[model samples]
Target: MRAPHTATTLGSAAPARDGPAQQVARFGRHVAEMCAVMCVTLILTGLAVTAAAAALGTSNPITGAPAATAAVATLALAASMTAWMRYRAMDWRPTLEMAGSTIAAGAVMLTGYAAGVVPADALVGGTCGLACVAMVAVMLFRFRLYASHAHHAPSGH
Candidate 1:
C-alpha cells in the first residue's frame, strides 16, 4: 500500500532559515554597530586634533580651522575604512580604491600648496572635499557590486 501523505511529502513544510523580518533585523543591527564604530572614531579624532592644536600653540580660531579640517577629513577616511571592513570583510579592491584616492588627494593638495595655487589656509578644505568625493565614489561602486550580486544570486538564495 502507498504511504500516507504528510506535510513534508506534500512540499508544504516551513523553511528552516530565518524569515525576511529576521534578516532585516540582523542587517539593522550590523548597520548600528558600524555607526557606533564611526561615532567612536570621530570622537577620538576630535580629541586628538584638540590636543595637537593645544600643543602646537595654534588653538586660535584662525589657525585651528585648517587643522580641524584636516582632522575631519582623516577621520572620515578612517570611518569609511571601518565601514568597508564591517561590510566587505577585508576585500582588497575597496581598500585599494580608498588608498589611491587619499594619495591622489594628498598629492594634489601638496602640489597646490607648493605652487601657491591654493592658499595655505584653503589646503585643508580642498583636501577634505577631495576625500569626501572619493569616499562617495567608493560607496557608489560598492552599492553597484552589491546590486549586481543580488540580482545574479540563485533564486533559492
Candidate 2:
C-alpha cells in the first residue's frame, strides 16, 4: 500500500523559492556586477589603446583607420574580460560568449564603416557601446552563472 500524501511545511528541508522582492534584488545585483565588469573592461581597454597610440605615433591607435582603432580597443576589452573570467574560474561557455559578442560588435562596426554606413568618427563610441550592451545581455541570459560568486576563487587552493 502507498503511504498517505502529506503537506510539507514552509520551513522544511526543501529549499525555499525567493520572494518577488528578493528576486528583483538579486536581478539588480546581477546588473550591478555586469556594470562593474564593463567598467573594468573599459579601463583595461583604455590603457591598452593609449599605449598602442603612443607606439603608433600620436596619430591614432592604428593610424588613418578609426575602424581599426575600434577593433583594437574591442580586442583589448575581450582579452581583459577573458583573463578576468578565467581567473575567476567561471565556466568557459559564458565567458567565450561574452568575449565573442564583443568581437562581433566590433566586426559589425567595421563592416558598417567599410560599407560607408557608419561614420568613421562614430566607430569608437558605437563599437564600445554595442559591446557593453552585448556583455550585459549575455550576463542577463545566464543569470545563474553571472550572479554567483561560488566559482570566483581560483581553482587551486
Among the numbered candidates, top lDDT falls to 2
Give lDDT per model, in order. 0.54, 0.72
Supply the global lDDT for candidate 2. 0.72
Error of 2 at 122 (Å): 1.1
| TM per candidate | 0.51, 0.72
Give the 10-residue window scoring lowest on summed lDDT in candidate 2. Answer: 1-10
Query: Candidate 1 lDDT, tens digit per residue, 37-143?
Result: 54465456657766766788767422456534554655565656645553544345555565566556756775776687977677765775675566556655665
Q: How do the residues 1-157 of candidate 2 rate in per-residue lDDT, one tens digit apiece?
A: 2232234557797544555676567667766665677677677776777786788777555436686678777887788777877765665776789899899999998999899998888888888889878887887797755544346434332
Candidate 2 positional error at 63, Å: 7.5
